[model samples]
Target chain A: MELLCLEMDTVIRARPDPNLLYDERVLQSLLTIEERFLPQCSYFKCVQKDIQPFMRRMVATWMLEVCEEQKCEEEVFPLAMNYLDRFLAVVPTRKCNLQLLGAVCMFLASKLKETRPLTAEKLCIYTDNSIKPQELLEWELVVLGKLKWNLAAVTPNDFIEHIMRKLPLPKEKLALIRKHVQTFIALCATDFNFAMYPPSMIATGSFGAAICGLQLDNGDQSLWGDNLTDLLAKITNTEVDCLKACQEQIERVLVSSLREGRRQQQQQQQEQAGPRSKALDELDQSSTPTDVRDIDL
Target chain B: MCRTMSINLSKRILTALSNGPTRRNLFGPVDREQLQLEYQDSLRKDLEDASRRWGFDFLTETPLEGGDFQWEGISGTKVPALYRSCMVGAVEVLRPRGASGLGSAAAQSGKENIPRTPNRDSLKPQSLEKTPEKTQSNNQSNKLKRKQTNITDFYQAKRRVVATPRKSGQ
Candidate 1:
């Protein structure tokens, strides 16, 4: 058995090929299915027990952090949230199970979207090992059943490239917009307020916000056009007024969240500093002569 | 390669049979989602039975996203049913080994075949000493291709390879 267990180090960990992003047919099909799979009502609006909007926010934020730490592709987190929202819409899940649900959704989403799926062991460790591999596997089946095994629901990231295709920006600015769009999408995933809008609308709003964030010089008359809002709306098949409202909502949420995150960081830093400083003072004041030995000499 | 080709062949057949206005109209006025539901419902038993026999948890693992199975070298097909069934069928037909024994046996067979291919030097008993050196060189080349670069460069490089056809008058 030992002889048979040969170590092969010739494997290549290829970065996911960018060509996958350009599959128009697959992307279009995903878009259609996503529209079909969207929940007709928000989770809060629906009559569900034990699950609330804040619980979703906490779980989503946790999922976002895990995905970022792991350096997963941009699609993984949003797709996981899609699974989470869809499952919550159809099934009544306990608040206690929300984190488990998040983990399983990510496990399933990564398998679908990533070249290497997040393994059960790694996911268990992420949850502080509170959920066992077997339990995660069991719930994986349950979530899949609830989703009716449709895991490729359209995500805002899906629309990023499509929208980028239409936007008239230089390569560098385009890259910035893409980054901003991704951040906006992740931010949307964390807030239940954004769920009411369709994925396409959210994508358009995010794109609009991303462009605004870039503050790209609109001097290129041919590309910038007189009215950016209408162009974005038309591209996504959304109404201009509705697109504006969504974009504003996204900006508002993004601003508040950014402030909130900074505030939390500051508080954390102060709290950490306070405890360490007090410990240092205690150490300085204590005399080293007081020694107690419990051993039987 | 053969595993992938056969999967692709079967998928192509399934899609060519099911796609287009004529086939879509056969189910007349049924919404796409409902039709998909019927398709999965009809195949659930077969899928479950295959899983039970093969001892593979396809029900949980497969994302059921789309049927391309492009990772398996199949494309242009939208039938998850055909792709999965052909995979199970291929596994069953190629290796008659018992379920528990199949994992290692298949792995061993794959490893054994790799050296026996056109790469003849790998098979010579004396060449065993040189194998690690050869694999090391191969690893270096693979690493070169897998170098980490900024996303902007990668995206630009990809865009150059395949200029996305622009929509007219967008």
Candidate 2:
């Protein structure tokens, strides 16, 4: 009876404090304006021989899975990917070390974003014990050094909340749109093709894509007219043409990502294993033993 | 030829410094305990402040760890340099064992043995301007007195060296 009373007496304080909400101007300033912060490498032209575009995708997927499994904060994975991309831009890392790099980046990012940061031991476990805590500790410095220790360099997720706040939608629809935007942002993180675009552009484009997808699913195109586009472009300070191009790319990836996710889900069911088992197997198969040996040199 | 020769000379000096008695193994095991206590005394407040305000954590929070301390929070434009400087400062004041070990090999390490010889090359111009002729002469005389002994002798006698007679770090 006492335990039941204590359970009933528990107070819920799960919601964010309204007083600590960020100022709109601060959010706008947090958006990456200068091209200096963007990664220099593209899919066609990369300085690192070992780190190909697909490798980035695989690592991003792994990071996303880890974040989801651990129930990390919303901003952790994208911020981690930002650090990974920026670090890879300047430093040519080995393929074997790529997963270690990813783990360390997320470790750094979670520290920055999560109240309870991901532990080094847990991150090593997630890597299937391929790396150790000491290795992660060492590479954290290397990644931080290569990134010039600029861990808070802006990411698309930074602008998502700001953009969502500006849209004229009800609370329920706004929540739905926000969810879609997060998916689009994650998809963009995996693809190196999106690296060239500014984070603001990506955020704006992802938001636009989300609205379109949500509206179409509800059989309502009225919410996505020219006025809405203009409003989004104006809010993000993006040109309409560039915004359209980015939105198109985002939608394209969103479709394929959805399909790929579904296919993987089916495969996991067939294999009767955890979601990560097949992906890890694919990663091992893709990087042949000879390739690993070549990277070590 | 001179540049290469200077490089080789510096390299030999560095190797010598590397092989010298470190604070860790100086008194054998007890030195480490003293060094750890000193490190905590000097760095405790600053580390706690940095950890609370900026989310930075000490590298020694875990055992058998190497490299710079990790940080959290939104990293600022000046943060990397600030963090490096803070670590450098902590290292300067407390003299961590790992940093001493690596500082010998990574020639760019700015923190090791700063009290003994304060990077006269970089400090020359500013110090020359700041320090008057009389003190400068006194420093030179002191160096002459100190130079009769080898660098190792200086290293050995460093703990007993006083700050009032010669402002070495300054």
Candidate 3:
């Protein structure tokens, strides 16, 4: 008898449990405890003397690219960023050690969330071998200490299901909507501006942005503009004005990020094509499909 | 030849530009010595804070004076080996909660190791730190678990007495 075993490489995922998703208490507890995981303050304004917001963006971008390239669990990237933000909020880290911190955060988050957690050696390689595996391991303790070992952070990804289940999304489009929302959550994580916002707010705003961007709202009056904002604000219990502002800010970040990703793509294409071969294919590039990139929320 | 040269040049340019996975260093070269000093310094600070909060000097393995909780000492043998604070004397590092029991697991002979193989180097330093992931130790590896005497394990109804019980019942 012949046996088939071609699918061994696929990640085995548990179906979303009805027990957790269907329970209102689960959502309430998430909302209640989510604030505990938020960074105590915006570190740039107070705690960190050396690290700037742009530097954060840079490290965050690098970290995102690594996670994407590695095909890490979707929550892994945002959770890692949560660790990074929480660590930076309390510790006065120097500029040189920022990447190390980023690596440590990924190490901790991946371990917390993945079945096959990223090994310390591989993470070190992603840092261009700037750090040794031993150093990564060593600083893991330091990062843990700084975080007070609160590794199970309530990330925006945690809120996606509870919020989406309540929204009037079409059943068929759920998969695509989820993908876009997850992408937005990862994007929000990379931007330091969204670091302090509660995970639920980010999740709700991402949902609003996803529905609006896809023009899903045109079908139903409940999902249109102010109505949509009111619905979303009610789902997450966010202030209406605050939710409106958050959703709009999320849209702006998406636009700028797309522009940045486009510019970077063009530059890379031009440089790769070299000066002699072709005219700057500016028009050709924009017509290309939107590739959700390192910063493309 | 010219095309090949352009491709090589572009490849080099991209590598220099830090695109894809060529993996450029973010903040430039780190001072290894300085990093070590800072790591030690931060761990020290963490230890100090933990000591104050828990009212236990993790380094000295003793309770501090005028603290929130009273201190008591127990011989390592009485408790389950997993909770023993000073099972192995050579390693003393600062973890806010001295789950030294875990670090001691690394030092213990193979007869009693946790089912998971912790990296010795990793466990060496965090001798005091709690390994938050050890929750599965209780459910797995019955052979490694050092089975204890539960009442049901040994106390069961007697099957029969050979003498006259069956005949008498009849």
Q: Chain B TM-score, candidate 3?
A: 0.45
| TM, every model | 0.57, 0.54, 0.76
Q: TM-scores for chain A, candidates in order? A: 0.81, 0.79, 0.89
Model 2: how far is A148 from its true place, Å?
1.4
- Candidate 2, B73-129: lDDT as tens digits: 454333433343345554355444333434453344321222233344444454434
Residues B1-170 of candidate 3 have per-residue lDDT tens digits of 32343233223322332356536688998889999998899889998999999999998789999999998877755666456555333123333333455445434431122244544564655442334334323333363555665556454433344435887978
lDDT of 1 at A40: 58
Per-residue lDDT for B23-94 in model 1, tens only? 011111213353345335635755675565555557565433443342243552344433445455554553
Give residue B145's lDDT in candidate 3 (0 to 100). 56
TM-score leader? 3
Cα-lDDT of candidate 1: 0.63
Least well predicted 10-residue stretch by lDDT in candidate 3 chain A: A288-297
| CAPRI quality of model 2 | incorrect
Query: By descending TM-score, how would the candidates be arranged?
Result: 3, 1, 2
DockQ order of candidates, best first?
3, 1, 2
Tens-digit lDDT track of model 1 for A27-108: 5565566677676567676656777787787677767767766667788998898888887887666565677778899999
C-alpha lDDT of candidate 3 relative to the true structure? 0.76
Clashing pairs in 1: none
